[model samples]
Target: MRPDLELVANLIQTDARVLDLGCGDGELLHNLQQHKSVIGYGLDKDAENIGLCLAKGVNVIEQDLDEGLGNFQDDSFDMVIMTETIQSVHNPLLLLQEMLRVGRECVVTFPNFGHWRCRLHLAASGKMPVSAHLPHRWYDTPNIHLCTFNDFEALCAHLNMLILQRRVVNRHHNERSLINLAPNLFGSYGFYHLGRTT
Candidate 1:
């Protein structure tokens, strides 16, 4: 598992129901089913990834997340997880609302747009940053709604969601003292565990 996924896996309770949005190849789901005994289903739009999921004996569905997760009923799962898929979605606010509606909690991970490297690159070259973390150019990037940690927290506040946990880490998903000093300026990515307050 990716180090970030390792962090995500830690947040889950054993034997819980989970829904993984934009699950690329069912790696996390497979790991969860084996180690945590989690009952989970992965959702993805790519046919090849779906094939890989089936091969792994993972329960998966083919679907575009941008449309909505309407096929699932309310409070259907214990947790809803979306890793690195928020920026690509059409309506992040609605997606989050739906996630919380269908599950008691949600976990989200995304590249930090407010990192110092991105800011420095933009200010220096006057063009969008194209680095290891965000390798795509502006014209071809799948990320449509890139945002900062502060931006996401504000949105959560607007929706009355409670932030259960938050972590800012380097590209390797490792935490260092520098990152803790000023996460917005140092950390390359962010991981958040959230829930409805009400």
Candidate 2:
């Protein structure tokens, strides 16, 4: 399993129902089912990923997150997760609202566009940054709305969501302690647990 995914799995509660949005290959869902005995569902737009998920015995739905998850009722699952896919979404706020509407909590992770290395590349090279954490050239990248840690936090506040927990990961995907100090400048990626404020 990828180190970032391992960290995500570790944060999820045992026996909770989980819905993984953009769950490529369903590795995290399958792991949760096996280790925690949790019920899991996955949503991905990729047909190949859906097939792969089914082969791994994971329950998966082939759907685009931008269409909204109308099939699921309010608070239908314990958690809804969107990892490494928010930047690609057309309407992130709407997607986030839908996640909150359908689940008790939401887990989201995304590359920090404002990371120091990205900044350095932009300043020195005058070109789009590409690194292990964000390994995509400008024209070919899937990321459309790259965001910083502070930008996401402000959006959460605007959406009336409470940040239950926040963590940062380094380039090697190891957890970092001083993430809150200057997450945009120091962190390579951001992880957040969110819930309704009221």
Best by TM-score: 1
lDDT of 2 by residue, 91-190 (tens): 9989999999999999999999999999999999999999888898989988988999989999999999999998887778776666557778989988
Report, for every candidate in turn, its global Cα lDDT versus the true structure. 0.94, 0.91
lDDT of 1 by residue, 10-102 (tens): 888999999999999999999999999999999999999999999999999998998898988999999999999999999999999999998
Q: How do all models score by TM-score?
A: 0.98, 0.94
Which 10-residue span in candidate 1 carries the lowest summed lDDT? Answer: 4-13
For each candidate, how many residue pairs have backbone atoms clashing (under 3 Å)?
0, 0
Deviation from native of the Cα of residue 181 in model 2, angstroms: 3.8
For model 2, the superposed segments whose C-alpha errors exceed 4 Å read 177-180
Candidate 2 lDDT for residue 153: 97
